[model samples]
Target: MKPADVIALPFQWGSELRHRKLFHPRGVLMSGRLERTAPEGEGLPLVSGPILGRVSKALGAPGRLPDIGGLAWRMETPEGSGKWDVLLASVMHGPLSRAVLRPILGWTGSEFSTLMPLAHDDELWWLRARITSTIDGGGLALTDIARRASGEGLDVTVEQALKLNEFQPLARLHFDGVVSGEDISFDPVVNEPEHVRLTPQWLTDFRRAAYRRSREGRDAPNRPTPEEAAEAKDS
Candidate 1:
């Protein structure tokens, strides 16, 4: 199955707080512009479920938006295998609102080049920038780097750095105000409105590329056989 196909499922995002185990005490949905209190266990670290709108209903959040959401799920696995952990992610970009993702996926626009701020904390960025400068200069013994996997305000699954195929998404998405995949991490009052834009074709292309590369890299061997290596050396 293609990553695009896999990602086509109704998307949901939220946080998986690990007070003990990998559990999602808070989860939200961007599919239908809804919010929920999150479901515990029986499914989490949330892999899949109805979108956040329906989840809001389940969690007792009134439906301001009239659209009924479909399955809501996130790629959360804080514990990898355990209990009582929170998954932090969001459905910023996923299956189209309806059957409206095809053309967007095929279009070629400059939307992807639009650099949006991925991190929110300016202070943190400033401090990290200083540390990065130190490292770039000649300093060692890492200063800004967290001592442990989990650190202060480091909601592991949500705000941590992203891997090649993994993304630590925010549970809440701000579409109108912020164009990035983060919530109102900046000055909320002045950020205008929080809104998320549709994932243009450019994004789909990027995703497809990422998926292809990931799959290929995963399936491909890191080292070649002795003969192959010898042949490479000879060549």
Candidate 2:
């Protein structure tokens, strides 16, 4: 099987973050929710943002990937499952358009369906890094990190992500997930955590984008939607 689906992958040039609600019982509450609200109680720090590496234009030509320090992590289902996959991406609020939004909706539904993780502005720092190039070939080394495979459940650490995106040193990335039951710990430099105020429209669009992309697969951990299985009910 192909390791990646580029079109469905996150950070395609001009992609805007969006959050779509999962049809699951737990996610039903996501609807009517004003904001997921930045994670609090971390007591680490409230990071602010000029969102590292944002595209200034609302939409750019094809192949305009986000500057490093952004991500689009995803997992596909096993063969024959016929389910929606999962996708997790980080966004810093630049622009949202029909060109970006429509393809996202259609593609995510056809490919990945679950919301693997929700990337927030505070997490963008992990995606940035400095690299050696210059007379030797100076340039930016950006990565949109992702797990190699889609497993029962995997814990994605911010450390690996940032390292891939911005070239943050190999230091460790550690965090606790509500359902992931994972505790991450790794290396030396912890990317700074600052909170910059992202616009409401940015957030709204991000959530919507996320929401749409999360439904990439045809199957979920729970039951299938009526549209998914004509044979599912009354069987």
- Choose the strongest candidate by TM-score: 1
What lDDT does each candidate get? Answer: 0.22, 0.22
lDDT tens digits, residue span 76-158, model 2? 11222222111222232222210121112111111111112123444422221111111111121111011111112112222
Candidate 1 lDDT over residue span 57-139, tens digit each: 11212223212111122222343332211111112232121122111111111011111222222211000000101112121
| Candidate 1 lowest-lDDT run of ten | 123-132
Per-candidate TM equals 0.23, 0.20
Which portions of model 1 show Cα errors greater than 4 Å?
Answer: 1-198, 225-228, 231-235
Flag regions of model 2 displaced more than 4 Å: 1-87, 90-165, 170-194, 197-235
RMSD of each: 20.4, 17.6
In angstroms, give how far residue 81 of model 1 lies from its true place: 19
